[model samples]
Target chain A: MPSSEEVFEKVQAALMDALGVDDDEVTPEATMVGDLGAESIDFLDIVFKLEKAFGINIPREELFPDDILTNSSYVKDGTVTADGISELKARLPWADLSKFEKNPRVQNFGNLLTVNDLCRYVESKL
Target chain B: MRWFWIDRFEEFVVGKQATALKNVTYSEEPIDDYLPGRPHYPHSLIIEGMAQTGGILIAQMQDFHPKVVLAKIGKAEFNSIVVPGDQLRMTAKLMSLQSDGAIIEGHVTVNHQPLAEMELAFGILDDSFGDTSFFLPGGFFRILRSLRLFEVARHEDGSPIQIPDYMLEAVRQEAAQ
Candidate 1:
């Protein structure tokens, strides 16, 4: 298994290619969407690149829980309910959802994924 | 105004790679209209040509059932300009394939000299896009026949690829109508 630094490097390169962002812009704190300007389509490209780079299979739901975010049972008045937060936490143990938990608007969820979170997820897979 | 950017398939391997030809000429309106005096093939059209070649390669893997569309261009780089009289050989190789989408690495060359290189992604549209079809029934099969895809196409096992029964059935239904 690659070290954490090596995993970050590969993840950074994947983001640079998938998002057309500069190396410096892919800092761990950078948000995948808001900071790097990644659209919904870009996630697919990123997944393809990461899978090739790491030689790991990434199920779509593991990284992008679109089904949970869109599920009516988990959302109320456009905000994720407390149960939704619990589900997200269970699904994404590597992600830092504390910030999102304060105001879990479904729209804000798109911008919640940070570069560090991605690195952690990749590490967990490794 | 036919939307065909590729003229013919020079080589085709099922679910693998395909090579197509596109000849640029001065008579085509885009050659002159795009830049007035440049008289060269637009890079966008070259990308489209590559996309079509790659799209067909992906579509054929599923017997052309999926509504394959060019979802994103990951990378495109042109090293030289292609003017009129240039016969471009565009090749697309399947790099990755999945149920939701596929990625192709494409290259364009003229006389063995590199012209452009690209990475393109194609998405398989699902039922959410609606039941509307992108083409009339059996329309694409006719287009494929005219492009001579089957003449050069073969399965990985070296067996010749045959038109799917559904396409032949659609053609018969259309002929009756």
Candidate 2:
């Protein structure tokens, strides 16, 4: 299996390729929709890439989060600490954490989580 | 085929107006995936079909060069379930289009009754495919199609929409004369 870092790189590359843009368009500090510019369909396309890259199925339920995957600062104090999903399920109700996979609208379809956040979460599981 | 997701085109002309049709059938695998005994059209697939039809209309204006990716579905309302043996009336209107992409409010209807509706957006999938190095058999398309996630009729309308002069010229130049 590939490392989470590798997976994140793949996801980032996928976004740039699918959206027909460059890495500059989706910087770590850029929001998926605002700064980088992604609508819902574009969002769905991104999800497909993540699923393919990790060879994993994204629980559909996490498709959309109200304030997730936004263009936010992930780097703090000369290191990358702040991230997207941090705001996605930050208020998780526990039991619903497992249910997050079933809701496609959660965290705005994992938009808040950079490839790094996603790899971090996935790595923690391993 | 691996790809990414982009955003709505602020200048997309289909802001809220479009017209087309969707011919449904039992052969669609997604129906069986959701309900075997009572096969019904999955809502997402329905939207994907409509988005394809709408995206094609938008792309035709560019003479099949511009790759318009469906960005989002906004304000979708479902009145009832769709199944095989249904001819859907699909329509989409441009709400806006950015230099990078566009957004359109779209929907489908059966027997003149609204079945599904949404505000959809589309963006350009960059030159990633051209790079080839990132290309891989992701198997994502197969899985998605199995669930009826995507269905594009193998046909070409061959009609071009009115586009800006430069785009038309570019397509003409690309055309094999």
Error of 1 at A45 (Å): 1.7
Candidate 1 overall lDDT versus native: 0.91
lDDT agreement with native, every candidate: 0.91, 0.52
DockQ of prediction 2? 0.10
Q: What is candidate 2's lDDT per residue for B100-175, written digit by digit as tens?
A: 5656667678767878777666775557535332111233223323323223222234232333454445446556
A25, model 2: CA deviation in Å? Answer: 25
Write one digit per residue (lDDT tens) for candidate 1, span A9-124.
Answer: 99999999998899999999999999999987788889889999999989889998988999999999999999999999999999999999988999999999999999999989
On TM-score, the candidate that comes out on top is 1
Docking class of 2: incorrect
Task: Show model 1 residue runs off by greater than 4 Å.
Answer: A70-84
Q: What TM-score would each prediction reach against the true structure?
A: 0.89, 0.41
